[model samples]
Target: MAMEEKTPVTLGHRSRTLTAEEIEKLSDDKETVSDFKQRKLEEEAKKHWDKFYMRNETRFFKDRHWTTREFEELLGQDFELPSKATGDQPTLLEVGCGVGNMIVPLIEEGSAFRFLACDFSPRAVALLKENPMFSKGSHRAFVCDMTTSQLLEEVPRESVDIVTMIFMLSAISPEKMPTVINNVFSVLRPGGMVLFRDYGLYDQAQLRFKRGHKLRENFYARQDGTRAFYFSEEVVKSLFESAGFQTKENSYVTRSTINRKEGIDVPRIFVQSKFVKPQARYLMQFADGV
Candidate 1:
């Protein structure tokens, strides 16, 4: 049987200018940035992604399929849309939104939502800006390192109604995970929602890591050397709750795929979650300093 052709998706938006601090930090990280050995590995991975888009640039998934089909069903609920019902459009932020995979499709669906997308890679952001599907009026894209930068500085606080983190959070190191989560929380309005999906424990991709590829703990190196961390259900809850979100839905999804070459079947696990911030407020107590 012939292999099914993989269709590439077009998801593009405009790129934002990096701040001076971001430029300086990127420049000073010479070991990671300029080291010939590491640079070669990084370049190889980047080249792979570039080639992936070059070949499959026009295809896009029509909806937030993973979240809609998995988490929404498990929780027996639906997204609580804004109540104002105004002519003004709702705003959405897609962190680690690669090439507009989710954002572009949402826009094309004719929903009255504006989107802002961010990825740490300059190459990804550049391709997003160049794509004809990127509409400046309704969408914006930027190269942002969420772990170190201030999200509110670029995007106004309490301005976004929905934030999507599809298959993106597992890519960051565990230490930096809090920073990314907090940044997302700071920008979301009270009663806003966050939709998340990422790899779960023992997925084929996790088990495939070789010995030396272990970066730290559960984190593993991909073929292109980009790092990924798998999350347990408890860990996912802690990460979001610690950032002041209330987990409305959390569950593990198991799916099987045929391994034709091995003449067998394989199973994959994905953790899907929907978390919301409560409408109630907590009082802050300040201590006096001498």
Candidate 2:
């Protein structure tokens, strides 16, 4: 099997710059959530998510069947397991995999890669395991908090071929995000890739937040105690590159989500990108030959 990496094509609804009024509205909220309150929210983050899953189970989110379409890297030629000659199969690790919504679709589509998935919420993991397809598939679903846990303990270092952080990182506090990215960097095989999609700056959800919800610049605490941090392209690039990933595609994807019954049609903004872990040969080279 060839280990050649493919460049992702740029296609999607590109996000537009916010108008002056919009900017003023976002900045209008000068007050931020109190530090003591912020600490309490952070400490109880896991519990809040667990309660969320316990309450909603697998029904809250629709299965992400569109992943293959959005991320062609997961389909066609890229989906094949390495041939018997290579004596190995690729692995995909999905951090913050809630209820197997993403993995279940991939499995149903007959993807050949072995999978390792984790979410801090035990209830989410349990709900995932309850899925008959997931239970019978080539995968492992466990409880893990990426901010503090070590992926190498679950799998060998530099062994994973792909890592997907779909809408996962935004859920974390911005200050601790570097730790999570560094941890992802450690487990990926050289030249392995990360597929990411998260809320983008000035998204509807962010704009909907009133002054009291602001935790910090671009970060907010929701009424449910769950938190979200909207991203700018610069921040996403900086985070991955600082952790040794080569950015392939980093851009804002925009869309209009409509609910005619409620007379709601709002633009949704998301940051989606692909980052590759540098190959070992490149890592070993310096300005002067060794």
Candidate 3:
């Protein structure tokens, strides 16, 4: 059998840039320059996100309809998402599972594998729990700040088989990303995998930002207070590699969306990757003995 090292998705779409006026408006910098200097918006990241969830209330990002499609392991009979299949049955922990947008679809499909969905925002967690599909039977949703908070406190140590980080890590400050990865690493069982998806460098969203909204280089804090960071492939690869993960898949995905009424075409670029934690030395030995 061949390993699905890369996602089997088309990778090219022409890039698009927002209009100049749109850039100016987005970069207006709602905070006073003096406040921006003194308060450090990145430090108050949690507050910004909390307020973002409060304002939009689980309605901003659409449910990800592409998850199970991109990752075959999600549906393959061999992996079989969570029933009493055996120790190898895949258990999942969605790192920043906001409002269960991604997990709900899988749960609705009826899986045997257990899932733990967590978000930093209490409101996001609350909203996830509110979903009609949410139940403690196969899914467990909770509030957890992966950057500073200990994942083990809410989850068992090294128990997760798959940790999904979809469109979520970009919200963390680049400086703290290592800490977040290390934290997630601590909770993953040996040989577990982390599936990642996020904005790529020079993506349309990054190109749309103007000066005042810029936080450092590719990082930006939006007028709504929530922030985002565009990633370079090297950076993403390095971050996971530094934390003892073996890179399996690391590539960019590009898709063009057309707006017929507005007569505009938008190109979106995203990075998709998969990294695996090494199995314990003794576990390898035990398997070899068999």
lDDT (10s digit) by residue, model 3, range 119-165? 98888888888887886565788888787756878987777878899
User: Which candidate gets the maximum lDDT versus the true structure?
Assistant: 2
Per-residue lDDT, model 2, residue 198, is 96
Order of quality (lDDT): 2, 3, 1
Off by over 4 Å in 2: 1-14, 76-85, 281-290
- Cα lDDT tens digits, model 2, 1-290, are 98999874332224756665666777688799898999999999999999999999999999999889888877734533222235677788999999998999999899877889999899999999999998997789988888885566776777788899999999999989999999999888777889999999878888888779999998998888999999989999999998889999999988899989999998899999999887663445558655
Q: Is candidate 2 or candidate 3 better by TM-score?
A: 2
How does each model score on TM-score?
0.73, 0.88, 0.80
RMSD each, Å: 14.2, 10.1, 10.2
TM-score leader: 2
lDDT score at residue 8, model 3, on the 0-100 scale = 37
lDDT of each: 0.69, 0.86, 0.77
The TM-score of candidate 1 is 0.73
User: Rank order by TM-score, top first?
Assistant: 2, 3, 1
Give the Å error, residue 108, model 3.
1.1
